[model samples]
Target: MAKLLFGSLAWFSFPSFADNKPLNSPVDYLSVLLSLVVVIALVFMLGYIMRRFNVTQQGGGQMKVVGSMALGTRERILVIQVGEEQHMLGVTAQNINHLAKLDSPLEVAQPSGDNFKDKLTQLMQGQKGKTHD
Candidate 1:
């Protein structure tokens, strides 16, 4: 009874491999590495193809967002350029409202002289001064 039980346990403990190769062989590792590289390459290739075809792009036709500002947690003002004209719109979670049409579109100002970190430090200092007063 002891011999039979030990034999059955030993048979179950070892897995049966059809190829008769060691589990951690170089060929297995090479195959796994090749498969990972192929999968990563395929993903990047698919992304490039989609971007090239504009399949995953937003607002590429006639309308473009010129500027936007958030008024509240759920409300925002957007300046969108359509064809040759620009329109201001009030956007909320529930609805969108057309505000006005501007003769010239708002141009984004380029930061000069100070870098972002310096500007941020100045803004923090200004806010602190305002709070003290």
Candidate 2:
């Protein structure tokens, strides 16, 4: 019985040993290093190009109209003033049809005020009165 048990255990251990060898080789390590270097070089090249061209100039200079009311209720058109110039943008289906088509960055500054909740409550009460009819 002891011999049979020993033989079975040895047979199961041989298959496991065959599969336990490491899968990666020296060439795999070299390939990974080469890829990392290539990616780093590409990123540096992109940074150099951006710095040389001055892409940041688009946001600061003279006023340019960059937004318009295209497709929304309440005539919600975005009007932006840059430096001195002003532009009237027609945000309609005839235009880019979406805000994403605008070329300039539009940021919404936070309003600094208290009593916003009171104003909201009043507006909600007014709306409730209208709906009751």
What are the TM-scores, per candidate, against the unseen true structure? 0.39, 0.29
C-alpha local distance difference test of each model: 0.75, 0.55
- TM-score of predicted model 2? 0.29
Model 2, stretches more than 4 Å misplaced? 1-23, 60-133
48-110 in candidate 2: lDDT tens per residue?
987565344434455544544444643446565555333344454455322334354465444
Worst 10 residues of 2 by lDDT: 93-102
> Clashes in model 2: which pairs?
63-83, 69-91, 70-91, 70-92
- Which candidate has the top score in TM-score? 1
73 in model 1: Cα distance from truth in Å?
0.7
Q: State residue 67's C-alpha deviation in candidate 1, in Å.
A: 0.5
Give residue 54's lDDT in candidate 2 (0 to 100).
34
Which stretches in model 1 have alpha-carbon errors above 4 Å? 1-57, 108-133
Model 1 TM: 0.39
